[model samples]
Target: MKQIALDIGLTPEPTLAGFLAGRNAEAVQHVRLWAESATRSPVPSYVWGPEGTGKTHLLRAARQALQSQGRVVGWLDTDTPLRTPFDERWDAVLLDDVHRYGPEHQHMAFNWFVNAVSPLHGKPRAVLAAGRLPPADLPVRDDLRTRLGWGHVFELHPLAEGDMRAVLRQSADARGVFLSDEVMGFVLGRFSRDLGSLMQLLDKLDRYALQTQRAITIPLIKSMLENE
Candidate 1:
């Protein structure tokens, strides 16, 4: 059975520790609850949001956490089909962009969800899924739609208003980089404003600043920008 390759551009390291769950705090906590051993297996959970809203990040985070605990976790992305005889050996399964599944696929997925949440083979085999719309708004099969909403459903809210800068400053501070307002503004102005890219730039600048024994000043950032 062939499966579609995962998106090459998805973030490489998406651990629970690394996720910057800003306005998605409550949702984040809900998802992480599945990782605890005593919390019960096959914990069917759903997280929904528009693209680039950390849905992929949180799904991968759960995968990493469960894998560390020695659970067999399966992850299927947007184009990947839910290949059947749906393996019950899996302790956790993460389905991303689930709204894309068509009628037949949805039926297969519905069955998988049913068994996962049921105590058929003891504690349920946990599942975490993400999509571009909430279960109620999803344009998939109604029965499948109802099942999706059965568990703890969370909406992955985008970062809070006006907090990105503070997040950058705090991240920089933690990494021992003095990201000045001027430089942060300049970087924000001149480069990609996405939180992920901005944070990566700040990290690289911190390393460069340490290597050159230079303060994180505008001039230093300017030089770094040139090399970048």
Candidate 2:
């Protein structure tokens, strides 16, 4: 039988204010400044780190910040089919998961990087990109890789256990639920430790709590896990 799964609970919007900068405080600050700066620099900013290190979070935060400021931004990722080259009307371009781009995506990324840095008309547009590896280590074309390293390059670090705990508690609070120390410890030990995974788990718990009219507890989590 084909089973359907429905998404439940509200996923918090990714924002700079919500980002928990543990070891990557400098990276977070740099992205914030770049997004908020009135003087647009041609030089692009790129962040590289392992999976689940908040690379996408920072990129999305920057996008939201720019859009809130009324800047037209073009966003692309490895999955986007770029049949046409990048347009110049955008005030900025955001590229996410650059390291996962295949050959055609690589071509598009290179073209977009060039156009963003040296547009034929007007000053250059700000370019922000994130990937899983450093520019030099990226498995992409030489030109695209070179452009990725041309400007500010930052490497993100994973959050500590203490920081992760704070994030989980804050998120639970936002969802109007209380996560006790025991539940927190169980979730941390029983599930994937990555922040993204933890957030998804919390969402599931939130939905289960709402559905059963019960507070999130160790027994609730155990039942949820058993059913899964």
Best by TM-score: 2
How well does candidate 2 match the true structure in TM-score terms? 0.90
lDDT tens string, model 1, 1-228?
A: 323323343224457766778888888887777775655545467898765577776887788888888888767664655466457787766777787887767777777777767746766777788888988988888887887788788887666535667767766666655777787778777877655566567666766676677888889987876877
Q: Which stretches of candidate 1 lie over 4 Å from their true place?
A: 1-12, 41-43, 81-85, 103-108, 119-122, 166-228
**Alpha carbon lDDT of residue 101, candidate 1?**
81
lDDT of 1: 0.72
Whole-model lDDT values for every prediction? 0.72, 0.86
Error at 195, model 2, angstroms? 1.8
Could you tell me every candidate's TM-score relative to the true structure? 0.67, 0.90
What global local distance difference test value does model 2 have? 0.86
